[model samples]
Target: MSKDRLISLDVFRGLTILFMTIVNNPGSWSTVYPPLLHSEWHGCTPTDLVFPFFIFIMGVAISFAMPTKSYDNTTFNKIVTRSLRMICLGIFFNFFGKIQLFGLEGIPLVIGRLLITAIVGYALMGNFNAKLKTYLAVSIFIIYLILAYSGIKSYEIVRLPGVLQRIGIVYFIASLLYLKTNQRTQLLVAVGILFGYWALLTLVPAPGFEITNLEKGTNLAAWVDSVLLKGHMWEVTKTWDPEGILSTIPAIAEGIIGVLIGQLLNNAKLIRSQKATQMLIAGIILIVLGQIWNIIFPINKALWTSSYVLYTTGLATLTLSVLYYCIDIADYKKGTKLFLIWGVNPMIVFFLSEIIPQAMVMISFPNPKIATGQINLLDYLYVAGVQPFFSNPMNASLVFALLYVSIWSVMLAYFYKKKMYFKV
Candidate 1:
């Protein structure tokens, strides 16, 4: 490993990406295994931890990726540009295959925008003129706004923000915090956000609903989403989204925890064994505290409760500790290449994973097995090739999801061989 690069960190990130891809691309959502599916509400599950874990990992990355110089105009501009590109790319992914121009449909405008944004953001490698880079990034954001506006079907306005958009927003906030604050202040700020969010949820009644309960579409968060987002919430739940406004406050805490972990790892005074022990001890304390807190606050992923943050952050800390011990401290580097591949180009792989599935779902084909009507390509393939082998639909569904992950792993491995580490 390079002096700056941590092998364990890469492996952890890669494994997180791997599982995220699997849970997201399950063959049949309806038949998914309990562990892979998010809890209905007010509870944490394996799947519930994935999104926060990614955010936490990003936070850890900030310690490594953040500019070393004093914050200045150039640094601010770079931060804004990178954040804009991420959010714009997110908007593009959400509208992929749905863009229409001059009454023409399926233009792949989203993908095109993504490519342009990637080029401006990553391929140039900060080599281009700063003003030009800013202009290109701003222009991409404008085009995304126009396309997103055009794609909206409802006249009610207010639109659903994409998952990537939410992640970008939290990322921007967390990164700014990192740039501005010392470790002590960062920890205080993170803790404040979590508790402050909890207080607001517990004390303030939902507008018109006149209750402070955490029920779906009835809580303060959902009410905020309904009024602010209007027609823009998740399609499945038009009234509210899991990644809505209020929940993200606590999400920032996850990122802060990651930053702390990164700092811990970077502390040269501490030996490798000491670092692992410290992390493990901290994790245990947080887990216990979270469980106790859950009695009142409740560990809910959808809500992104303070208790949930504590629990997930605790788990993530422990996870990184184990990986660090095995990979970095023990010098046992066997069989980590698979994860390294995805880790090096995480967003690229994740973006493709998301968009490719949507594209597959959009292309319709005649399903001979269906007797008469047409089915989308994904369903057609599932029916003909995957669904018949097992009596349990869930098992077959899981198999299909694993296959999707395996395919991506192979593609990423090839990219790894070529050393194509696409980043922004």
Candidate 2:
């Protein structure tokens, strides 16, 4: 095995994933301030940036990590095995990662705070047949629309193709597309998907979709999802799903953007200064283009709008460029020990946050009322320790999450010292 070192790349990935944990597994979601909340319908927020940025970073990582030459059987086998593992893990999270397997006897906890789980399944799974995936995806929605129009059932804890599932489907094709086609074709395909999605949203009126306006309840995407997965829609958005069919068009761009970054990173001959400068310029260009696109597309995380992809991708790339210059070129390895830890095993911490919220939240001291029947360990600490003195729930929650990050950082540092990296 070739053990190549890319300090900046690992650090960038690590820092992004580490912040992902903090924003994802806070002490209390409701208690979080404005920056954490995803924009209600349109616009951006710190929370909104997390997922797309993660995806964008994945694109950057994929570009840097893909082999430069022809694949050998040994390398091919490893890639296949790892890809299969990622796909299965994504499925596990989808079906059972939500339910705390053991209610009381075992270490019971919320398996996942968020419903989106398609990140890995798509990225790794190869789309053997582009036609089949598109057919299946379309078929599922058509069947769902028929059922939904029939008013067969009310929405509840029903599951269907979602963000992760979409990723699996689109990613398979996108990966194949990346390998099978050239760069210009890839860019064209990306643009086509984006515009195609927009046109569909505007032209085809969903059931209950009016000629005047398609509100959240009546939006084409939500209507299609509800119709298809009648009994399987999420409890929260009975009328709409964030990871709906039409919405995924823009989502594919997220993965495609990754492929683009991967391509950029593939040029090994480019000097560090050249790479950094290119990224910074690209970031500036994207931010401006995103703003222009926002006039029509509306940069939305829920929809994963095209503008949103450009805006977030640009930021992610620029950030990576700066970090590369600082960490890899300038050689600042002091406090980076923390980020390097997360860079080692990000998914582990992500899973842990879901597996054990109490630990992530670091619930201590006296517990307080959080949700309907839940009182977090962290809440107790906040009320009994900080709330008595401070009044900001948001600040307290941020502090709590940061503290959790720090504790985990210590563990990560230990593993880093031992030179261990647990990958998916």
Candidate 3:
């Protein structure tokens, strides 16, 4: 099988990339869809589902794209080379994507840490005894305790858990799992992890773990986060470390779901009509399961609760099915050029936006408001230009979001025409 139908995967990926652009870059933070706002702590939101869905879908793509257990040395080398390139790109995106080198101390330390991390990761990424990997993971947790409570207050960058790091770690383990375990066992692990997190939060008492608020520094997750990672890192949530240790469990599930998705898509034996029906039914089941789980567990983006995973996975599947139906079955792909562009180079678009915000922000001019001389540029723009036109902040934010996507959409359109796919 070719393992790729550009329309379905790109459309689905494009959908995700579009939301990423929209959610990340609204005209004003104050305005957004109700679904867009992350549930404070114990609940779920549409916005919360976005990142996991994206990563999960990435996993799906990986399954389709990656070679199976059998491979020649040349092919293996190619896989290694590509994986290495991706790891580097992901790290670069982590370090320089959103940061500016201000002075001597930060730059040198950043370089020093990257060197150390590379050495450590290089040493770390070989065939270890299975139990040893488990032990190392456990030991890493213990060391995290020592660092957090050891009272050696130092802001070393690598000490923190970040989006790329979490992805790296989780994906590494996930690859091993895929190699070593059966589907049933992997599913059980995911279940255990989610419940384990729940038990920790509910049973293990922090000073005020029971109380859920936006103050990430004190929450149960934050306590673990503060203990495990101590630097600036927020990929999942703005207030909390988006890729917190507690949340990685569900994130892995996202990848596993992708495995299933890939299985469905890759099994070319199934007729297109059969695949569409199966996907639709599977998506519906997930949505139902997510809703039911929400009653007890609460679908939370920050938490990456199992229910949220199920719900988002379902929605993602359904969305993919629809795209497949339209583009392939119905043969109707009139205006998907823009999204296809962004879709092909989603990671590049993301990292470029993060790194090149200076040039990218020209799409919308900043309108600074003098609120007793304390002005916020982002909010001011929304108030002056967006708010006057749209009554609600959500509408204004949505408009800005559309424009933001449109800017990238246009760039992608040109990239699409030029056949420019900036792959990592």
Q: Name the best candidate (by TM-score).
A: 1
In candidate 3 the C-alpha lDDT for residue 236 amounts to 48
Candidate 3, residues 1-424, lDDT tens digits: the string is: 1234547788778877787777777776666677767677766666776677677777667655653744456544444434443444444444442232343343354455445444434323433554454444445444544543554434234234445455555555555565556667877876776667667655666554565433345657766665655554554443357677777777887777766776677667998878888889989998899899788777777667778888888888888888888888888888886666777777667555654442233223323444345434445555665668876667877897787677777877877778766543
Q: How many backbone clashes does candidate 3 have?
A: 4
Judge candidate 1 against the unseen true structure and give its global Cα lDDT, from 0 to 1. 0.79
Task: State residue 120's C-alpha deviation in candidate 2, in Å.
Answer: 15
Measured against the true structure, the TM-scores of the candidates, in listed sequence, are 0.91, 0.76, 0.72
| Residue-level lDDT for 12 in candidate 3 | 74
Quick one: RMSD of model 1?
2.9
Please provide, for model 2 over 373-418, each residue's C-alpha lDDT reduced to its tens digit, 9 standing for 90 to 100: 5444556655566555546778777887787788888888777778
Go through the candidates in order and give each one's C-alpha lDDT.
0.79, 0.63, 0.63
Q: Which RMSD values do the candidates have, in order? A: 2.9, 7.1, 7.6
User: Ten-residue segment with the worst summed lDDT in candidate 2?
Assistant: 104-113
Per-residue alpha-carbon lDDT of model 1 for 83-146, expressed as tens digits?
7766766666655554444453332543554455455445323445777767766887776556
Tell me the lDDT of model 2 at 405: 80
Question: Considering only N, C-alpha and C atoms within 3 Å, which residue pairs clash in candidate 3?
Answer: 31-393, 44-299, 236-242, 237-242
